[model samples]
Each structure stands twice: as C-alpha cells, then as structure tokens.
Target: MLPFTYALRNLFRDPSRLAQTVGGAALVVLLMVSAAALNHGMTQVLSASGSPNNVIIMGAGSEESIERSEVHLEAEAAAATGIDNTATILGTPAVSGEITYQAPIRTESGKEEPALLRGVLPKALLVHTTVRLLEGTFPNSGEVMVGKLAHRKLGIPENEIAVGKTLYFGNVAHKISGTFSAPGTVLESEIWFDRNDLSTLTQRDTLSAIYARLDNPEDFDNAHVFTLLRNDLELSALREDDYYSKLESFYAPIKIMIWLTVSLVAAGAIFGGLNTLYAAFGSRTREMATLQSIGYTRKALLVSLLQESLLATMSGTLIALLIASLFLEGITVPFSVGTFTLTLSPSVLITGLTTGLLLGTLGALPPAIRTLAPKLNKALRS
Candidate 1:
C-alpha cells in the first residue's frame, strides 16, 4: 500500500493543477450552499409567521390574498361575540380587524418604492403575539410604525426610515413614530398605521380581514362552524398556520427555478473539474505503473488518488464556508411579500458538506480508473 505521505506530496507536484482542483470545487460547493440557504430562509419565514392558535376570517372569495379581501365592518362584532373559546387578555377579546395595502410611498430622499402597509388597532398585539415594540410607541392618528426590516423592502438606506423621519403617502406625510420586530416572520417588512388613519387615507370602508386567537388550537372547528352558520356575513375561517402553509405552496415554482439555475451552473463547473483531473492523472500513468512493478496493488494506487482528491476538495469546502459566513450570513433578501435573512442553519451546513464529499469521491472515480486500466507493460511504454 502507498503511504499517506505519498498522496500528500504528489499534490504539490503541479501548482497550477492543485489550484484548479481546489478553485473548481469551491465554486461548485458555494453555489449549492447559496441555493440551500435561500430556499430555507424563504420557507422558514413563512412558516414562523403564523400561529396555530389563531384563526383568520377573510371574505369568502379572497382566501388566497388578504390584501384583496373586503369584509363588512359589522363582521368584527359578529366574530368577537359568536366565536366560541376565544382567548382574551384581561377582559378584552383577542380580535383584530385590520386592513392590508400595498402601494408606493416616498422616503425622506424623495425616492419612491412599493411597500406593504398594515392598519391595525391596539388589539392587534393580542392576536399577533410575536410582535414586539422595539422603540417608540404605537402609531396614532398622524403617525406610523416601521418594521425593523422595512428599509430592505423599500430599497432605501436604514436611516431613511428611521424614527423621527417622515414618509409620504401621496401628498400627506406621516411621522415614523416607532420601530417593531416580529422575528423570523413576514411582519418585520411592513409599515403599520392606526386603523382609522389608513381607512381615511386609502378611502377603504371595509376591513381586509379579522384575526382571532382561540384558547386552544383544537377549538378551530368552532370558528369554522361560526363562519358557516353566519352565511350572511360572507366570511370564511382558516387556521393561521394553514394559511401560511398555503403561501409556501404558492411559491413552489420560484423555489424550483432557483434549483434549476444552480444545477445548470454546477453542471458546467463539475465537467470542467473532471477534465482537469483526467489530464492530471493521465500524466502520472508511468509513475503508477512503476509502483505496481514494485508490488504495490492497483487498489492501493486508486485509494491514494482518491485521498489526494478528497484533500483538495475538502480544503475548497472550508474556503467556501468561510466566504459564506463573511458575506451571506444575516444578509436580507426582499421578495414580493416580505424580506428574509439568510442563515447558515444546520440543514444548510449539512448540504454543503455532503456536496463536497460527493464531488471528491464520485468525481474522481472515472479518471482514477482510466489511468490504471492499461497493462503494466503498455503503461510503462507510454
């Protein structure tokens, strides 16, 4: 058997080949890591945005989009009174009748971009338990509260939307009174306004939806039954967690596109790396043949070659991980609905390490076999 040092020493024999192998592996592994992280972040944010103990009541026909739903103001009173097992804080019922709008708003720099807006009353806090006021106060008649990541969605610098700044909704300006956070949820990318203020500004007479929190998740059927019995209200009830799960399904095509793009690019890099390995191994045929003559088995030579390949690929994997930590971690990406932060979660790390191992083992097999294929005499002559 070839000593471990033999494979280690051979790597330094050609500086250019060593660099190519390592660089190619790094590029391929980095692309895979990026894809995994992006998809995981998007899914994670959506899943965390909903609570099992809450139920959403939207207009019957607009179940897919809350922004387009229109519910009569009277439905709020009906839901609070009719829904059984409703959760409460002190004596107030955990119900929030709100409006959701998407429109362009001008920043302090006069730059305009479309942003999500939610209109809510103080009771909104009861239904959305994840939200926390990080600074300042809740929006009042002439004020608005910004989410911690709203700037990313608005395509502006963080200072542009900081507290004390003003944002223009058409000709009227509203003070940025506060900033709030809903960690790992889509709510962090929205601008929240007082319910009455948004109603007058948007000229909306109807509520977009009503959110109600139940004492137990199993009580969901009671809420669903309430909607059925009050057919005159034209309302539909759905568990909040199920609503977000449906949104995740709606974005399936976008995730598929991301994977397709990564696979195409990685294929090109893999083939390029394979060609380099074939050339590097081809040139060492005579040396391998000499080792066989010295009583070293062909299987031993193959293992040594694989060891050399694994070392280079693993080094490249480390480099890729370092780069990801420095640049990709905590970076926010905005989509149509909200913004999500990239994270190197356990699943993403496992994906990257597995990709590196596959490339090192399977990617090296073809060239290693071809190099040792010829008879000893023929290989020596070459």
Candidate 2:
C-alpha cells in the first residue's frame, strides 16, 4: 500500500483543482448548516413560547390567529369565576385579558416598522410565567414596555429603544417604560402596553384573548368544559402549547422551501465537484498504473484517492464552521409573528460533518474506480 504521505502530497498536485474541490464542499456544507440552524431556531422559539399549564380563550373560529380574535371584555372575569383548578397567587386568580395588535410605529428617530403589540394588565405576568423584567418599571398610562429583543424585530439598534426613549402611535407618543425578556420564546419580540391605554388607542372595546393559568396540565379539560358550557360567551378554549404547535405547522411550508432550496443548490455543487474529481483522476491514470506495476494493489490506489478527497472536504468543513461562528451565530431573524436567533447547536454541527464525509467518500468513488479499471499494461502505455 502507498504511504499516507503519498495521498497528502497528491492533493497539492493541481492548485486549481484543489481549490475547486474545497470551495465546492464548503459551499454545500455551509448551505446545509444554515438551513438546519434556521429551521431549528424557528421551531424552538415557537415551541418554547407556550406553556402547557396555560390556556387561551378566544372567539370561536379565531383559534388560528390571536390578533384576529375578539372576546367580550367580561370574558376575563367569567373565566376567572367559572374555571376550576386555576393557579392563584394570594387569592387572585391568574387570568389576564389581552389585546394583540400589529402595526407600524415610529421610533424616536422617526423610523417606522411593523411591530407586534400586546395590551395587558399587570396580571399578564402571572400567566406568562417566563417573562422577567430586565430593567425599569412596568408600563402605566401613556407608557409601554419593550422586549429585550424587540429592536431586532423592529429593524433598529437596541439603544434606540432603551427605557426613556419614545415611540409614536399615530399622533400620540408613549414613553419606553422598561425592558423585559422571555428567553427562548416569541414574547421577546413584542412591545407590551397597559390594557386600557391600548384599548383607547386602537379604539377597540373587546379583548383579543383571555389567558388563564391552570394548576396542572390535566386541568385543561376543566377550562375546555367551561367554554363548552358557556353558550352565551361564544368562547373556544385551547391549550397554549397546542396553539403554538399549530403555528409551527403553519410555518411548515417555509421550512420545506428552505430544504428545497438547499437541495437544489447542493445538487449543483455536488455535480460540479464530481466532474472536477473525474477530470483530476482521469489525468492520473498512467501514474496509478505505474504504481500498480510496482506492486501497489488497485484497492490501495482507491483508498489513497479517497483519502485525498476526504482531506480536502474536511478542510472545507472547517472553513464553513469558522464562517458560521463569525457570521451566522446569534443572528436575529424576524418573521410575521416574532424573531428567533440562529445558533450552531449540536445537531447542526453533526449534520455538517456528515455531509462533508458523504461528499468526500461517495463523490470520489466512481472516478477513483474508473481510473484504476484499465489493464496495467494498457494504462501504462496510454
């Protein structure tokens, strides 16, 4: 068998071919890594945003979108009174009536972009247990609280929306009261307002939804039963986690499109790399035949060729990882509902490594075998 150094030395034989193989592998791996990270981040944020112990009560036929849902303002009091096994703190039922609105609002810089706005009472903190105030006080009349990552969704710098800054809604300006964070959840991309303030500003008398926190997951049935029994309320009850799961399904098409795009682009890169390998191996046929005459087996030659290919592809994988760490990590991406940050999790890293191995081994096979196929004398004389 040829020494391993023989494989290593052959990789540098043609500088252009080496660069092509490495660059192609890098592009393919990078695309796949990015797609995996994007899908994972989006799915995680949606899933983490909801809690199994919480239930959302919305108007009938509006289960798909909270922003479109409308319920009587009295529903909050009714649910608090009717639902059993609800979580309570100091004898106060953990129920919050909220209004959700999406509209473009101007920052202090006069920049306008669409923002997800939620109107809630202080009791909102009871039901959305993940939320924690990062700085300043909660909003009062003419004041609003911003999420820690709200600036990402608004396409502005964080300092632009710091506490004490101002946001304009129509002709009125609201002070930035504080910043809050709900880690790993979509709530981190919203701006929250006092329920009454939002109702007056949006000119809506109804609540968009009622949030109730139950003592346990099994207590969801009690809330569901309450909704069914109250025919006059026209309310539909759904578990918070289930609602977000439906949202995840709603975004399934986007995830599919991402994979489709990666597949098409990676197909082109794979074919291009294969062609480069074929040409490079074809030109080395005589050299392989001479090695065989020196008692090196065809199998040994094939292994050496694969070793060379793996080295190039693995180098490309390292380059891709470096680029992702520098540019892709912690990138905040905003969508219709919220924003998510891209991360190179363990699963994404494993996927990239596997892709590089497959490209190097399977992509090099046909060319390596073909180059060694000729009779030893025939190949040497060619």
What lDDT does the true structure give each of the candidates?
0.95, 0.95
In model 2, the Cα lDDT at residue 89 comes to 92
Q: How many residue pairs clash in each candidate?
A: 0, 0
Please write out the lDDT profile of model 1 over residues 132-224, one tens digit for every residue: 999999999899999999999998999999999999999889999999999999999999999999999999899999999999999999899
Clashing pairs in 1: none
Q: Candidate 1 deviates by what RMSD?
A: 0.8
Error of 1 at 167 (Å): 0.6
Query: Tens digits of per-residue lDDT for model 2 on 1-382?
Result: 7899999999999999999999999999999999999999999999999999999999999999999999998889999999999999988999999999998989988899999999999999999999999999999999999999999999999999999999998889999999999999999999999999999999999999999999999989999999999989999999999999999999999999999999999999999999999999999999999999888999999999999999999999999989998999999999999999999999999999999999999999999999999999899998
TM-score of each: 0.99, 0.98
TM-score, predicted candidate 2 vs. hidden true structure: 0.98
